[model samples]
Target: MSEQNQDKHQQRQQKVKQKVDERIAAAQKEQGIFQVITGNGKGKSTSGFGTVARAVGHGMKAAVCQFIKGTWECGERNLLEKAGVEFVIMNTGFTWETQNKESDTVAAQVTWQEAKRMLKDESINLVMLDEITYMITYGYIDLDDVLEAVSSRPAMQSVIITGRGAHRKLTDLADTVSEVRNVKHAFDAGIKAQKGFDY
Candidate 1:
């Protein structure tokens, strides 16, 4: 081949390689393994549920294990269940709301165990651990266990951990972390938590 033609060929190959590199970088940015939604505000679970919806929309399998606030009828649970999202509710109301620490702790532990199983399932593309911070804060489950699961899930699997008072360690392990700050809520304005809106 002529030297000039050889140079042109090399340039074309370089351009193609650059394009491939760019595409791979974009794909990696879109893929993530760990996420946390936390703060004193509401919508932590709602944010997690939104991810669940997105995952389900893409036909990805998902699992949700809600720790506290499980007994109440949740609209997300109802809708997602019908859509083939596996859900395991702890069935223990809020510890403060229930005024039963022991029972709540036991329930949280049980739910965490189930979540751990779901996290290890290679078939599950996404796992949402709703209200998981309470389990860590109350010592119902070891923070190390949570960290290990977040770190060791399938390379492409994503996990969403949601609750207020998220520990610093959890945040450190998260690839994406968001805090939902509550500026104001209708409940503070004498509006009850409506069935569909709040519950």
Candidate 2:
């Protein structure tokens, strides 16, 4: 590249950096953020677990309440649990797989009690509700209860809600919201879900 072109590129990048710096300087809040991860694409729960791992790395206590996974051994479960995260897997499987609403509701309610306890615990800095959207959609857990629990939790305790189809109310209440879009997946192309990559 010509020296003139390189100089122009550097100047452009500097201007962009200045704008970003200004925005960072303008923001002044320090409270814990409420984040919602949802959509048809994968990685919602994966991102939640990533946040849990981040919190643990920062010496912060985290609690994990998995809502719709079965008895399968997940990589995050093993890693987080071994790292001393307060982990709990609530559901036996997806709703269709279970074919038992009554038992599912009972299990969800019991598990939510534990989650609520963790929410109220100020010492726990992060609470990950993995695949919790299904609980609300399936009527196993009330949306109002979830809102109240997170709202009344410690000022510095973050709550991460992960799953598809996050309700508008939940997103509106969140400080940050991200929807992962599904463009393509190997499963749709007659390929099976592989270990580590899919789960």
lDDT of each: 0.89, 0.89
Cα distance off (Å), candidate 1, residue 17: 21
- For residues 1-199, could you state the per-residue lDDT of candidate 2 as single tens digits? 9999999999999999999999999998888889999999978888888889999999999999988884766888878788999877784877788899999999899889999999999999999988888899889999999999989989999999999999889999999999999998888999987878767
Residues 52-131 of candidate 1: C-alpha lDDT, one tens digit per residue: 99999999999999988788999999999999999999997778787877887788888888898998899999999999
* Per-model RMSD to reference: 7.9, 1.2
- CA deviation > 4 Å runs, candidate 2: none
What is residue 27's positional error in candidate 2, in angstroms?
Answer: 1.5
Q: Cα lDDT for residue 83, model 2?
A: 90
Top candidate by TM-score: 2
Worst 10 residues of 2 by lDDT: 69-78
